[model samples]
Target: MPTLLDIEAEARGCVRCPLSEGRTQVVFGVGNPNADLMFVGEAPGQQEDLKGEPFVGRAGKLLDQLVMEEMGLTRDSFYVGNVLKCRPPGNRDPKPEEIESCRPYLEKQIELIDPNVIVTLGNFATKLLLNTTQGITKVRGQTYPYGKATLVPTFHPSAALQGGGGDVISKMRADLVRAKKVLATC
Candidate 1:
């Protein structure tokens, strides 16, 4: 089996879709490859694309704070990545075709990392992993079992930035607590 680094190297040179043509860099993932907990987000934002890393933007800052203060975990303890390595043009939602093209790479990352608990941030990540079209409001904070992993759907940190308010933050915090508890058992 190819190691994560090998997969990342391949991803870096990927030209499978139009996204690769315009991207500054492919945001493969970051943090511990052997992490027991993994966070899957929708896709790379401008900052992530520029930095060639996932979740280093404003929302990432909030996420980092939550992981550090709320869960008592740091970035080093978890793997953070996106469903699509390349940024969608104008930061729009990724097209289904784009996702279809890139899904296997994300799947391979999951296989390699083999995280015990997977946190799906926002609607896109949650929908893709769960194979459902359910809204985040309906599914957030719920846990679903996927093979050997426990998957949790939660609000995207960006949702909070989009006027989701204190209620959303509270729910996310509760979900983080659940994730931390699951981590302890894993």
Candidate 2:
């Protein structure tokens, strides 16, 4: 089997979709490769594109704070990545073709990392991983089997930042707590 670094090396040079054209770099993933927890987000944003790291912006700060508060864990304790390694121009939502092109990379990451819990942040990641048409609001607050891991869906931190209000933040917090509960049982 290919190691995580082997897959990342290939992703860095990928031109599978139009996203590769405008990206500054591939934000493949970060944190412990052998972690029991993993966070899967949508796609890279401007900051993530520039920094070559996932979740390194205002939204990331909120994620760190909440995970620390709710699960008592930090970024080092888990791996975080986006479904699309490359950022879409102007931060637009990734197109269907873009997602399809990147699916193999994300799947390989999941297989190699082999985390016990997979936390999907936002609608795109949740929908794709669950193979469902439902949005995050409908599928969250619950866990399902994903390979050998438990899949937990939650709102993107960006949604909370985008004026989702205290209610969204509260629900996100609850989702994190729910993930923690699953982790404990694992």
Candidate 3:
């Protein structure tokens, strides 16, 4: 089997989608390769694109804070990735064609990491992974079985930053706890 490094190396050079044309580099993923938890976000924003790292801006700081406080796991404890490795120009929602082109890489990452739980941080990741048309509001705080791991749907940290306020934060915390419980049980 190919290692995570091999997958990332190949993803870095991907031009399968138009996104690759605008990105500074592929934000493949980052964290402990053998972690029991994984986080899947929607796509890279401007800061993530510039830094070549996912969740490195204000939203990232909030995520770091929540995971550390609620789940007691730092960013290094779980792998963080997006549905698309490259940032969508202007940070718009990723187009369907873009998702289709980039999905294999995300799937490969999940295969290699093999985490006990996957916490989807927004509508895009949640819908895609769950293979559903539902929105995050309907599915947030729920857990489902996916392959060998449990899937936990939750609000993206950016939502909290964008006036989702304490309610969103509280719910996100609960969702993180839900994922942690699943990890502990497994």
Candidate 4:
């Protein structure tokens, strides 16, 4: 199997979609390759595009706090990445063609990491992984079997930034608690 580093290098040179032409860099996953948990987000935001790292922007900060402070996890203890390696223009939702082109890469990453639990942050990641059109609100905090992995769908940290309000935060915290418990049981 190819190492994450090897995959990262290949992604950097990928032109599988038009996203490659606009991206500053391919933001692959960051964190422990051997982690039991993997967090998958939608796509790279501006900060991530600039830094060539996933989940390093405002949303990332919120996620760091949730995983580290709230859930008692660390950046080095879990793998975090996105469905798309490249940023969609103007931080727009990834086009269907773009997702189709890049999905194999994400699937390969999952195969390599083989985490005990996989967390899908927001709709795009959840929809892509689950192969469904169900919104995050309907599926967040639920667990489902995906091949050998236990998948948890949750709101993206960006939702907090989007003024989803205190209710959303409370629900998010509860979801994290559930996720932690699931990890323990697994």
TM-score of each: 0.97, 0.99, 0.98, 0.97
- Per-residue accuracy of model 2 over 55-136 as CA lDDT, tens digit each: 9999999999999999999999999999999988888998999999999999999999999999999999999999999999
- What's the lDDT of the predicted structure labeled candidate 2? 0.95
In model 4, the Cα lDDT at residue 24 comes to 95
Most lDDT-accurate candidate? 2
| Cα shift from native, residue 72, model 4 (Å) | 0.2
TM-score of 4: 0.97
Can you give the lDDT of residue 149 in candidate 4? Answer: 86
Residue-by-residue lDDT tens digits, candidate 4, 83-124: 999999899999999999889889989988999899899999
Ranking by TM-score: 2, 3, 1, 4
- How much does each candidate deviate from the true structure in C-alpha RMSD? 0.8, 0.6, 0.8, 1.0
Most accurate candidate by TM-score? 2
Q: How high is the CA lDDT of each candidate model?
A: 0.92, 0.95, 0.92, 0.89
Better of 3 and 4 by lDDT: 3
lDDT tens digits, residues 1-186, model 3? Answer: 999999999998899988888889999899999989999999998999889889999999999999999889998789999999998888899999999988999999999999999999999999999999999999886789989999999999999999999999999999988988898999
Residues 59-83, candidate 1: write the lDDT tens digits. Answer: 9999998888778999998999999
- Choose 3 or 4, whichever is better by TM-score: 3
In candidate 4, which residue ranges exceed 4 Å CA deviation? none
